[model samples]
Target: MTLTKLQKKFAEGIALGMKQGQAARYAGYSEKSADTQAYNNMKNVEILAFADELIEAQKSMLKRRFSGLASIAVDKTIDILQDVDASPQARLNAAKMILDYAGMEEPKQLNVTADVNQSNPFEGLTTDELRKLIDDG
Candidate 1:
């Protein structure tokens, strides 16, 4: 999945923390609907895969940069959890810290469904009344 030059630039800009619209523009995508265009590009599977590779590389670099800190933090968190006198909130925080460090934390997806505007606006209307309403519309 090779990206064109513009696509490469767009992905790079995204990795560099630029907004999609700004990244698209930086990649020479000049359009009146730049935001929409950028959104479409970002949703492309190949582009997303490329971007993920770049992000994973950056994450690896950061992990190596903080190599020693991770183990120390995890050990301290385990100690906190095993302490009986720790506050409930403190224990919870320690749990979360370990989960986050282990990369087990993820945003939960919620599904919300609602029914609105269901009543017939022309309920109980006579034929003449309904015709009038349709004509008005």
Candidate 2:
């Protein structure tokens, strides 16, 4: 969806805020300045685009944080781009290797206690049994 000028401005501000937070750590400047500069530098649409990237990066960063893994996900992502070969065959090979590695790693499992099925009376019934019961009834 296309955003209004105001919406664009808001998104730009948010993007700037995220950038400021990161920049503040490296440069001895206030986070707010980063935000203001980001807003001022880009038009509404560019700001919105940047906002989307920022949100994705934030989500990835959060996932890294909660997983308690020590590696910097951002740095790794950068490394992947830096090492990318321009040739199609080479890139394809790299992609395959990455997919293989990712597939080899186990995904983290979540714990849940609640029994979710409450309303399905015939949930556990076999198809034949259900048909027979329906016919009998």
Candidate 3:
């Protein structure tokens, strides 16, 4: 159902956080009947739905704005990481910040046991042989 012009105005006012009576008055209802008008408007399904739509739109806009700000913040953090004149500690902190924001903080230590009976592939290899092996690989 579509809302009337005054009802649309009242919904807009309500979406902006005005009190019901104030919204009714802002919608051009007489001061003497503003309270009554407000009460009636509040019970209207169409007006309530319109007000909810406005609120959702506002939330979407804020989310987009915050996303842009977050992008700028991440860019600044990356700049700090790349700055040669930044202190070692500052660069380290920036690196950590970026890693944390990217959800890649350091992993916990893991322990592994090797079987003593297993033959070693590179044991007793000459240094030159190892170098050649690495080069070929």
Candidate 4:
């Protein structure tokens, strides 16, 4: 769609992260009425469609800029996983990296209870009990 000068500038400003009212004012819209103008402009179907295109274009640019980091991380983790000399903790971390790459974040259903009225657990223990606990640990 062919946009007027202000519409073009407004779209560009929005693409560059400006809020609607800010973009409208930057595009030479009246300062006092810019908020209303920005709201109305955002309601226009052509402007909405153009904004979608702008967002998708920016996504492509961003992906290109950061594309190599994921592969490098995966490769290093894989190497760690296959190395027999790696510490057990290190190998576990590498496995976690693979899970993270697959988008499997930690399991979320752990049930924990906190008793607000409960005093410190160790406060009731005698000195001998504390010494035994510390020695066991």
Candidate 4: misplaced stretches above 4 Å?
Answer: 76-97, 108-137
**Residue-wise lDDT of candidate 3 within 35-106, one digit each (tens)?**
999999999998999999999999999998798799899999999999999999999999999999989969
* TM-score of candidate 2 to 2 decimals: 0.23
lDDT of 1 by residue, 7-112 (tens): 8788877887899999888888877866876899888988878777888889999999999997887899999987889998899899888888788966899999
Question: For candidate 4, lDDT tens digit of each residue in 79-137?
Answer: 99999999999999999989987889888898998868867989989999999999999
TM-score of each: 0.48, 0.23, 0.53, 0.58
Poorly placed runs, candidate 3 (over 4 Å) = 73-137
Sort by TM-score, top down from the best: 4, 3, 1, 2
Q: CA shift at 6, candidate 2, in angstroms?
A: 15
Weakest lDDT window of 10 consecutive positions for candidate 3:
113-122
Cα-based lDDT at residue 34, candidate 3: 91
Which structure among the candidates has the greatest TM-score?
4
For every model in order, what is the number of clashing pairs?
0, 0, 0, 0
Error of 2 at 70 (Å): 14
| Candidate 4 lDDT trough over 10 residues, lowest sum | 44-53
Sort by lDDT, best first: 3, 4, 1, 2
Tens-place lDDT per residue, model 2, 2-102, is 65444444554465564533433233334557556444534545655856887788888888776754345434544554574556665555565555556
Which ranges of candidate 1 are over 4 A from the true structure? 31-33, 71-137
